[model samples]
Target: MIYRNKTEAYWEPLLTIARDELGIHSFDPMGKPSADIRMCRVEDIGRALERAYDLGLMVGHTVTRAGCVNGECA
Candidate 1:
């Protein structure tokens, strides 16, 4: 999810990432109340993070073990 910020300069790069990298063909602001956050699916989260990092954006993900559930370990 792209968090909304006051920097309008980031908008173009964000859109480019969403379209070219994230495979989002189109954007519809009317479909939602706010256009702040944009959520999309990418084939690989690691690749997405790399792309975002290259664009000077910081993206992070957390991994848990298979036996872990809701922060608890079996």
Candidate 2:
């Protein structure tokens, strides 16, 4: 599923990778995991999420004018 919302768009890929590649079925975003996913770095995921947020902001600006850009101007 293609998620357009910022949170899901950012996390869904990482969650999928955690489940498929790492064989982790008990992953929960709200709770701590019992085991870490192999070869995954917290810093890397954070950077990716930031990038996703930026991309989503750009797309949202291009599609609609619902909110002020960067809270600078309405």
Candidate 3:
């Protein structure tokens, strides 16, 4: 429910997907892949986005971005 900033709230879900589904533990801006990583399918992206929406984590959402405790982003 608490995020460091708007960016964090937005990126949390994607990062979770990267970690949980891809087994990616860390990242580097200019780093190259060191192993053969499994790619996420369209379905995976859809589900993660949906989960973020259901949790009200998107921009304009009151759950995290706007700091509203009782309203949803519409």
Candidate 4:
């Protein structure tokens, strides 16, 4: 189940709960929120990918300060 912590951004607080509480692995801090929430699951890698999509994470490309890599951003 998803939950919250001290963070106030879109998905920032969940990171701490996922790692410190649920013990799930977190992604690298790219496309990081202003805060630090992260999502977790017992076995839901697809769900995590969906969450990233929901949060406007463009996919299938390398992202950088310039823009989406090769017209994609995942």
What overall lDDT goes with each candidate model?
0.56, 0.54, 0.56, 0.49
Q: Is candidate 1 or candidate 2 better by TM-score?
A: 1
Error of 1 at 58 (Å): 12
Model 3 RMSD in Å is 7.4
Per-residue lDDT tens digits for candidate 3, residues 1-74, read 23355465547665676576455454433343544344677776677667666656445454465555445434
Residue 64 in model 1: lDDT: 43
Q: Rank candidates by TM-score, best first.
A: 3, 1, 2, 4
Worst 10 residues of 2 by lDDT: 28-37
> What number of clashing residue pairs does each candidate have, in the order they appear?
0, 0, 0, 9
Question: Which stretches of model 2 miss by more than 4 angstroms?
Answer: 1-37, 65-74
Q: Encode model 2's per-residue lDDT on 1-74: one tens digit a residue.
A: 23355475436655554455445453444343433334656766566566656767877786565445446455
**Model 4 lDDT at residue 49:** 50
Count: clashes, candidate 3 = 0
Cα shift from native, residue 56, model 1 (Å): 1.0
Candidate 3 wrongly placed segments (more than 4 Å): 1-14, 21-30, 33-38, 57-74
Candidate 4 CA-lDDT value: 0.49
Q: Considering summed lDDT, which 10 consecutive residues are worst modelled in model 1? A: 58-67
Candidate 4 lDDT over residue span 1-74, tens digit each: 23434355645634644455455555454354643464556456555455556554433232453376455556
**Between candidates 3 and 4, the lDDT winner:** 3
**Which pairs of residues collide in candidate 3?**
none
